[model samples]
Target: MTNLSPSDKALVPFVSVDHMMQLVHSIGVEPILIGLADYIEADFKRWELFDKTPRIASHSSEGVIELMPTSDGEVYGFKYVNGHPKNTKEGLQTVTAFGLLADVANGYPVLLSEMTLLTALRTAATSALVAKYLAPKGSTTMAMIGNGAQSEFQSLAMKAIVGIDTVRLYDTDRAATRKAARNLAGMGLKVVECDSAEASMEGAQIITTCTADKQYATILTDNMIGSGVHINAIGGDCPGKTELAPAILERSDIFVEFPPQTRVEGEIQQMAEDHPVTELWQVMSGTAKGRTSADQITLFDSVGFAIEDFSALRYVRDHIKGTKFYHDLDLLADPDDPRDLFGMLKRATPA
Candidate 1:
């Protein structure tokens, strides 16, 4: 690799998985989460200026593959992600992703980065950012249902953004809860393990569900949730996959990222076509109401929108400018002359 010639060295910045972990550790995860939250909020506040649409999904019995894309007219970003719930049984992550950011002016990629970790980070940041507007004032405890890869990140993001310092973790698999609890230790948050989802909700004002099962599941029943709680439902992200009971959706004030997208992919998909729901961006823009009462139930039906991936890509592009965490990838062919394609290839060929 060291013998790479400068003549063939037109390179794009590439962030590998190892480098992403290094970047997170170097800048600190909470600070990055806060920074990403700021970017996401900024984008939401100016939600009218972007080209928005629902993500394109291709589904199968095993899982789903999706392409989430967005543009602010200056920069465009998209993430390629897959969800295979059965992958865990074979010793692999249930979800994995990669993303790219490009300059709209030149139509050339500026950065390509591994988005598996970034997705988890931005998802947690999005939840916490929404909770800042929807959660009850002085909320300090969160019930982390479905303790898996996202549980620790969600717990930390809430602590950083909404001032929650205690997280009660629960999972159908006890080992997942133990894993979450272990990862959360020394992160300045008190972590608790519970035997069931209902037990985890004890004394918690915020409940986050992040299971990876690709089916209709009642992680929380109507009777399990009470008044004055904010629910961050992160599991039910595709059609035929939902985490809350229909009765719970009926009573809560639901909020979503995009109506057209959420109607088909989010928890709101379980409701009627006319079932009322508010867009979170409207709340951020002060055009609609958020948490109006301390006793009101608030639900953030997050389906992992494209704008978040855009924002996360932008954040990485900005912070990684001077860092050594990225490598140069020769992904594009650079010809000596724009029109002399034959000559450029002939020159590169060994005689």
Candidate 2:
């Protein structure tokens, strides 16, 4: 028996939660959001080249767990995410995730990273990226209708990527709104804590809803929304969860990530299966229209797609180079002789 060290092929770069936070801090949150938006936009432009599908989801009364997978022919990526809205009552995270990227050529993992923080970042980036195309010109104020774990990230991403200078916040829970207000302090945005959702929407050009109830709840009604505003509805990510009334869907020119997935899991789930909706990728690639009129209502039914996660993973993989934000994880077995895995294991043991 002989001692042997794992080869480079056996090592996968892993970004832990702490390292992710540090990486974010080192690069600055807004800059990372901007970079992620660029990556996501770039991928969306090449949307035709990647494999796409609805995420595989297992639904339970409490929440849903899902696996979102996609590949760009060269690199493959997947994310394991869970959404348990009730977990917050027990002081746990309502949403948490991890993801991996692998080489499609040899099926070896290239990167593994905690996606809880990254999910929040990517979700916000995706929202802002869509808003950039759909939101009205000279849009500077946003009405953020949900103030929970994702509130601050959404606000910052909008400011960083979409150039929103003011954020009006509202939530059912006053404390949550206050928390978001406090967290958003000194972030170079005018933070206004509102008493009601309607008040929050006043003078807002972009309205983003991200409530976390696992039921058919209407956080925004049709009357609450006016013309010439872009609605970013991200909270409705499962079959039973939604944020806007169906009438709002009817009034707005809806945009979605993937029609199949958004129909099953996004705000459009409330609409008829044949209801007209534009695929966002097509809009990004200039094949379709986005916010054609200043007075038209544009709605982005965001359910958080696999391609966005793939983009985030790709961004992290590219930026983490020449930095200490990740560690080499020995996650694979490499035998000197490819067919001698058993012999390699035996050699690893002491006589």
Clashing pairs in 2: none
- On residues 1-351, what C-alpha lDDT tens digit does candidate 1 reach at each position? 222243433577999999999999999999999999999999999888889989988888898899999999999999999999999999998889999998899877889999999999999999999999999999999999998889889999999999998999999999999998888899999999999888999999999998887888889999999999999999999998899999989989999999999999999888899899999999999999999998889999999899999999999999998999999998876665558656666677765
Which candidate number has the best lDDT? 2
Worst 10 residues of 2 by lDDT: 1-10
What TM-score would candidate 1 get against the native? 0.97
lDDT of each: 0.92, 0.95
Q: Which candidate is the best by TM-score?
A: 2
Candidate 2 segments exceeding 4 Å error: 1-3
Q: Please state the error at residue 254 of candidate 2 in Å.
A: 0.1
lDDT accuracy of residue 321 in candidate 2: 99
* Residue 238 local lDDT, model 1: 91
TM-score to true structure, per model: 0.97, 0.98
Report the C-alpha lDDT of model 2 over 37-145, residue by residue, as the tens digit. Answer: 9999999999999999899988888888999999999999999999999999999999999999999999999999999999999999999999999999889999999
